[model samples]
Target: MLRTYFPLSFISTLILLISTCAYAEDHTDELHSATTQVTGFGTLGIAHSTTSQADIVRDLSQRSGVGASGRTSLALDSNFGLQLDQRINENTDAAIQLLARKADKDFVPELTWLYAAYTPNDRLKLRLGRVGFDAYMLADSRQVAYSYTWVRPPVDFFGSLIVSYFDGADAVLSFQDAQQGNYQVKLYAGFARGKSYTGHADYDFSLDGSRILGGHLAYQRGAWSARLGYSQLLVKNEYSSLVPVLDAFHTAPLATLIPDAAQLSAELGMQNKRIRYLSAGLVYDAGPLQVQAMFSQTSTNSLNFPDSYAAFLSASYRMGKWTPYATLSASRPVSAQIPLQPPANAPAELVQLYKDLNDGIHSQRNRQSTLSLGLRYDLSDASNLKLQIDRIHSREKFLVRKEAPDWNGQTMLLSASYNFVF
Candidate 1:
């Protein structure tokens, strides 16, 4: 089924998908004899940016398809996803999820997760194939807006890090709480590939790596819950940012001054690199009030590409079917100076080249802070409408980043969406 949003039909767009699924499910229940089940989640969103310099995107891998200086766009915030779950037996099961989204204003649908699971015992479960990284409290539920209060999880914690799927295996161990809370520990190992978003378009090569490993420990007791996770990956950054730069220099006078400078400096762009991530979070949801906070860090083995950290806190009060919430989030790069500083008296061309390499290394240093307030209204058992506005401030022209120098360093975003699950 298709949910189209014409000027007037936008109101119906929010409920169309959910209503369609609900109707189908109600009819199927009468003849329900299949072991397999199908379910879905979707969102219809309209958003605008005050900066008009860049679009607010879901994550680093995604470009809003508008902005970087444009009035408004729809390719940035609309998405649809479907899942199929099949139970082969008491011990075996399989599940798959596919998400349709726009990357750089164009449709680039991909598989979110697909795996076969085996439960041999009550406490231990094994899964193999493509699966989500258990990075945070809501990593797996990123697409399901109804599962969380935010229109999207904070970009600092979720968007900065790119690795989301692993083509490997995992084991989860479950245990009873010592007193009140229950516990679960998950360990995974695999290989993965990540595509790079060069602001408005994709780069020539994606980040491919091997020997990816991670583990997560979580505890929950009634209204209180906490989790900590860590993961490391051995990556080969083969995107080759040096070739074109070096080729341009071949005919320049600078080539004679510095021999094979581009090739020597190319390592600054990073290849055969290692990546590590650490994250922790706590949540409380009891009665009418809810609170949540999380912190995450991303680092790499190379000196050129250093580290970044982000943290955010949020609270919301539930009043009947409406939940009004506020959140504060901040992200900053642990910026580092390049070790190879050019001579002060060097030629202007040479000096600019050095600056180019230095800036390239610390490009992620655009620090940002955000304050957002929103209200969510439940429309039905499986659908809700959300209205949110965010004030964004940045230290540099980094965020709302574009392939070109389009970041205006500050912006405001107003958004509305209808989210549903069925």
Candidate 2:
């Protein structure tokens, strides 16, 4: 039997919130003079997509997007976050972060990070609890809008991530070479539960307890930084929504047309599967020019899930308080097309099943590229305003919602945002 596992962070957050509230009633003085610091960051934004056939979304977690949801919507990139950092001792510290965004119908807040760090020596540090997914360069700080040049992370490269945090422990080791080149190595292991929003409903995915491990190597020199990373996960998921589809495959009439119906059913199930990811990133910054590039690939053991490749490059130049940038990004599935064709004389039920199966396949497949041009004006040290335009060429359905049958895939997007940190 299979069951959905709720994220542990939710329980932890409730416990912490209650304890702090009760304690504050008795020790308000201690709370005010405690060794703690509070900080926050957010983005106020709106966007428009030229086509009304489908709505463009930042990631799979969002239920609505920019086009069909509205001509202009704040749900795409607008968000807020608050963080508290407390120093427990000279060698220990703890932090918790709460984030609010349009993941559902309304702005709901959730605990994104809650971790305790211990540093016993200058060269090493350890952390335990729910930590950010550090699979790529921007994975940890992707929510801090003021830290990046783009209005949003490129959809082709960042939209496919399934989870952002994992309950785990990690160690970081720092080293310095003879020429004073700095290097760092990080290793982590954890269990996670996350969901992807299918047009119908949420599909819960589990990373099976302790079935994840990964590491990354990073190097830094004068005006350059480089990183290489690898990670693998074991998936144990049971999609309750797919029961009806599987039943039809096993039925008498449809089974007669597809003799290997049982095999096909097994291929559609997502259980005891493993996925591997590899990534590389480079950045250069000097004076008024900065350039960034990254590449990643994902391969999975499931037959219906396609292997994919994604990459992006961005360049920006700063002139006084105004900066201009350009970026190009693309992603596509490399796996062979699924062989799900049914006979022409098949029954009505079989034809309907074919359409259902095809849509499922297309949901995971991506073939798209985008060219973005944008400019940023600094409002202050803690805030900035940006305007961007993207010419999107989507050969296949990409990061979008409510795809219409008669819609073409070509479109343009105009976006603006105000980013601030405190």
Candidate 3:
């Protein structure tokens, strides 16, 4: 089967090696045969960073990081997942995947995907329940580390997208053309319930009722493929960390600094704000050469949240069972200007509050870029080993914990991982 923009179709990409075996069971009145498939993937990785000031994390949902937390850590890049697929009749099937990964400083098992797929015809398919968030090209299968060549996805491009799955539904429409190749369009809607760490241990929050809606179009022709996607998410809850800040806007010295404290407080609140994301990606795999590139833009209605642009380009060449790859990724904010600042002679506490507020406005101004080189060696048909090194440069805080007093905005990261599929 050819890959499409749907999660089920993505199994044909790199995880197609999941072979099915038959099993027998006794029935009292009748005898029947059914195919129940079990498949799993995992990565055991150790990563090291040169920086000892700020810590590095894979995504925003994680509470701990590598670097300052520890120069080398296994919890940073290590994860495991298992999936079960059951076929019911010819047109309907169900699948559920359980994944164990670090979130909120603990390795917790959670259902990453649980859906029943109905294929009414050859060209259409529908799914309901918890489905993978397909906002980017690789997002549908991002948890399956063995499906990709990189030891891990680039942090600069994927780190901030904390939501992995949404509980709702999706539909996929596919068409095939002899001359143009396969075309697929997918649309999805759901509400997310993902937890996020706010860099402070005491300031975690959940996206309980955030509504998400998105769609994508994908085109594949032989060894080349392309995808364009757009998504809009409306945040429905406020951060607990902001309660004090909002309260402060109505209090003594802070209220004296501005006449429109209420308005500024509203702008700083994340509740009920809609964020828009747009992305485009291209991939080519021909013979021994493979290339992938993606660019994305994100904007939010909240004045405190800065707009951002992120992009990455990767290429690899295969030689027998070994593959060598290189990647370049970057992310930058549209503006770094502070939304509001206090006067020079303001009280020290009020001045600090304004500075914190300004930092929140330009929080996305990391101006981060990274270059990575890696090698992957096939250990067997079901497993592979990878070694990679990345040089990261940033003008501000990258995807990391709060900065230390002497922290620099550059670091060299070394990683080693063994990825397996069973």
Candidate 4:
């Protein structure tokens, strides 16, 4: 499966490159005078974890002990991506991006964004086809540049319970006035139906989902920017006994040992299941100093999963080639009622163990916090380097008979990347 998928993804990338080159050649005369350009950027990173309790794998662009207890191993966070832009005419253009990474257990390149856009005038623009929505000004650009002064965006705050990339269409409208300063309002609605990899190990749920609607509004004057945005998603899962069984171990204890009969009854009880989220953010930038903060909450009633809330604050200062930054983030689980045991006919030991586990798990509501600090250096216009360290503390107790183990882990990471426009 790895061999087959790798080659297929490579072939598709090759086709895109060739097509882009061909298009450039056909418009060479226009290219000389046109502002259109093609650009590419990538990162190469390596890090090691010092603690034995957690494995240091590159989950995203940072080295963290997250999900390390199962397969504690060293890993790399290497990724490459490309962007293409064509200026069809003044005030109108098209652009697309592709990214390859070790997001899955194997290497695969995914279509990050592909869209045609018309700027029309400076205050408004329209886009069609797989557009990238900048929920925050820096949100869309987060992963592309490793120069951001953090091992990774605080996971507690940025983690999405559902899918990341969205498909379909969107638009942006801006309003500018001399006395009122400048305000940008963006409205977008889309639907996406595809398979996405959720970070959890137990569930490899194939997604047949759609994004109902979302939008962002921002006001900026001088060095300060404030944004308010809301987005909602409707996701459906195709049942798989194997995937659920694997995921159950990680879910709350009560949901883990459900009997076959109880599972059937619960399925019947849940005729409708939906996951939804809403988020907002704010940022301020002054000479040599920058600050940002965000808050998000999510709810899913049918999965017996608790409603979740996350928030983070980050600040950075630049001095010459070096920029130092600090970040703090936290998340908590909501409350929910889930199944705890099977039928009376089940094994005596199994039933007893299940009860003990469930009781322990119920005590562990959502509770986790992370602190990070880092430095960033801009080597040049096309290259940069970054180093970041993270300390994570998970307070939720496990449902096992014994007390859940405490997670106090530290992670260090070094990363470098280059960007070029062709």
Candidate 2's TM-score reads 0.86
lDDT minimum window of 10 residues, candidate 1: 1-10
The runs of at least 3 residues in candidate 2 whose Cα sits more than 4 Å from the true structure, single-residue gaps closed, are: 1-33, 198-211, 247-259, 341-355
Candidate 4: lDDT of 60?
A: 21
Candidate 1, residues 329-395, lDDT tens digits: the string is 9987776445456655788878888787666555545367889999999988999999988787766
> 302-336 in candidate 2: lDDT tens per residue?
65456789999999999998999999999888865
Q: Tally clashes: model 4.
A: 1
Better of 1 and 4 by lDDT: 1
User: Candidate 4, which segments miss by more than 4 Å at Cα?
Assistant: 1-30, 33-36, 55-76, 133-137, 178-180, 193-199, 242-272, 336-366, 396-422
Q: Which digits, one per residue and each the tens of the lDDT, describe model 3 over residues 1-422? A: 11111233333422432332111122312223445666678887888889877777787787777777788887777776778788887999999987777776355568888999999999999999998987999987877778899988988888767578899999999999989799999999999878876434345667877999999999999999999999988988877878788877878666677777877888878789887889999999999999999999988877645678899999999999999999999988877666786766778877887887776555445468899999999989899999999998866664777668677688899999999887
Compared with the true structure, the alpha-carbon lDDT of candidate 2 equals 0.78
Between candidates 2 and 4, which one is better according to lDDT?
2
Q: What ranges in model 3 sit over 4 Å off?
A: 1-32, 178-180, 198-203, 250-257, 343-349
Q: What's each prediction's TM-score? A: 0.86, 0.86, 0.89, 0.74
Cα lDDT for residue 153, model 1? 72
Residue 129, candidate 3: C-alpha displacement in angstroms = 0.4
How many clashes in each structure?
Answer: 4, 0, 0, 1
The residue ranges of model 1 lying beyond 4 angstroms of the native Cα positions read 1-27, 30-32, 198-205, 208-211, 245-267, 336-340, 403-408
lDDT of 3 at 393: 82
